[model samples]
Every structure is written in structure tokens, then in C-alpha cells.
Target: MNKKIEKCAILMVSTDLTQKQIAEELNVSVQTIINWKKKDEFIEFKDDYQRKYLNNLAAKAIRTMDKLLTSDSDQVRYNAAKDILDRTGYKPTEKQNINMSGSLANPYEALTTEQLLKLAGDDDG
Candidate 1:
């Protein structure tokens, strides 16, 4: 909770500097940084900072994906559109795989004629 530990946690979250580097920058020994990092308050602050940082990064990535939807390359546009859809809970429906305890006399009995054709990838039902 001290100003020094707070600064250390902020540096640790905001930059790619190692603890030793941060200690040198802050005019403290690496041992001090390591010790402060192990404290409960330091841990809590660092975890919250990291979580917020990641959330911001994810937002940026989503924005980038949205921008990529207008790209000239068809493949890039398609992939970005798919990524956005997948992230926004618009994923393509997938057939469920059901397991039965025992074999049935006719496995296709439960399926309609159209359903059977669709499952077989048939041209006509």
C-alpha cells in the first residue's frame, strides 16, 4: 500500500521491464522488488491491473477485426468477419453427436426422410 510498492506494481503492469530493471529504475534492489511483489496488497493490485490490461487489449483486437472486414483481400475480409461472428456468439450450428447404450433395430427410424438425405449429403430427399 506504500507509494513505492504501488509504483512498482504499476510499472510491472504497464511495462515489459523485469523486476530487476524496475528496481534499478526506481533506485531499489531487486530483492526489495521481489519482496514487495509477494505481499498481498501488491498481488491484488497487480492482478487487477493485468486483468484490466487484457480486457483493453481484447477490445482493441475486436476493433481491429471489425476494421479488417473491409479489407481488399477476400480471404482476409472473410476470416475477420468469421472471427467477429464467432466472438459475438454467431457461430455456425454444429450437429450433436449422440451416443446410445445399445444398438437399435433401425438407427434411421427416428430421422425423417429429409433429415436422412441431409445427413447423407444427398442432392434429393
Candidate 2:
């Protein structure tokens, strides 16, 4: 196609601009920009590929953290991770789950919060 359009694709992938933003700047319709994206042509830039990969990894790490964060016990953590992986298409490496659980000093922190508060009693006296 046009060299201008090829350059536009590279620019769109390299920047954080939305389709509307790029379209407005390039004086093209948003639909045209979106069509470019759907063909994966716009995402061919090195920065764009890296950004997408990093975002995916961050998302998966966050999901694993979320699964590990809410547990009150080892069994609970195991169950939660299993459920989360099942729902999110995360593959559970045996070591990955075990490592996640190992990172917690106390998974029962939530249960202790109220007990600590009760021990402190009311300071509003």
C-alpha cells in the first residue's frame, strides 16, 4: 500500500495513543486504524510487541498474587490457585504454586486483624 500508511502503522504501535487519537492526528477514520490493528499489522513494532508481552506477564503475575493473597491456610491457597488457574487459563506448575505459598509469612493475616483489634479494645474511650 502507501508508504504513509505503513509509517502510520509503525507509529500507532510504538505510541500509547488510542485509535481515535492516532486517527485524529493522521486525519484518518478511526475505523481505518482499527482495521489495521485487527490485521495485527499495527502491532509489528518492536516496542509494541514488548509492551504487549510485558502487559501479559504483569497480568498473569497479578492473577497469581491474587490467588495467593487471600488464603487463610495452605489448603485454601492451593484451592484458590487451582480455581484461579482453571478460570484464567493459567498453567499451574507444581513449583509455582508452592513458591507462591512460600512467599507468605502468614496467610492468616486477615483472621488475625480482628483478634488484634479486640485485644487492643476501644481507644475512643
Candidate 3:
């Protein structure tokens, strides 16, 4: 791969710059950058670079978790703990698991005619 394409891949992941901005910064045409992106090597390089960057960031955040949790500011501690928990897959929303076997008959179909009609807001009584 050319050095410029390598540099472009790094810039694409490490910065929030648009393709036009990157082209201007690198002194290359926007089409050149778009062309490089279509290459398999460029795609692989960008994905690997971004994954490594995020892994490093996560490691750094984990290292600072203790300090953040013990910070003097209540909001800081709360936010830090919440961030850690969220990253660790803790969700505040309710989760319901419904088991669906091959058979269609289940709890939902057990309702009586009146019960189903009432639920549908069609009950006249």
C-alpha cells in the first residue's frame, strides 16, 4: 500500500474529519480517498485501527474507574459508576423473555371469547 493511503486510513478512524476535509489536509482529490476506501486493504486497515483504538480507550477508562468512583463530586461518581455499569452490559430497562415452541397454542390463546372481546374494546355489556 502507498504511504498516503495508509495515512488516509489512519486519519479516517482517528479523526472526525470528512472525506473532503481529509483530502484537503492530505492534498489529494476526494475521489482518491473514496477510491482507496473501496480497496480491501484499506477496509481491513481501517477496521483494525478502529478496533485497537477503542480497546485502548476502554482499557484507559477501566483504569480510571476507581478514581472516578471515589471522586469528591457526587455527580462525577454517579456518572462514572453508571458509565462503568453500562459498558459492562447493565441495562435499566425491563426485559421480558417469551418462549415460543413449535406449537402455536399458549397462554395468549387461552382467553375466553368475552375476555378477548373486552380486550379488543368490542364488549357491549
Best by TM-score: 1
> For each candidate, what is the lDDT?
0.86, 0.67, 0.87
Cα RMSD (angstroms) for every candidate in the order listed: 10.6, 15.1, 10.3
Candidate 1 weakest ten by summed lDDT: 96-105
The residue-by-residue lDDT of candidate 3 on 1-125, one tens digit each, is 78888889989889999999999989999999989999999999889989998988987878799789999999999999998889789968855445676453455577888998898899793
Per-residue lDDT tens digits of candidate 1, residues 12-115?
A: 88899998899998999999988887899999988998898888898788788888999999999999988878878998987555558544356588998889
Between candidates 1 and 3, which one is better according to TM-score?
Answer: 1
lDDT, candidate 1, at 105: 51
Per-residue CA lDDT of model 2 for 1-125, tens digit only, reads: 45546656656656788768878888889888767666644456535656776787888877766867586788878877777667788876544223355673543465666666666785443
Native-structure RMSD, model 1? 10.6
Error of 1 at 2 (Å): 1.2
Model 1 ranges off by over 4 Å: 95-125
Please estimate how well model 3 matches the true structure, expressed as its whole-model Cα lDDT: 0.87
TM-score: model 1 vs. ground truth: 0.66
Residue 95, candidate 2: how far off, in angstroms?
Answer: 9.7
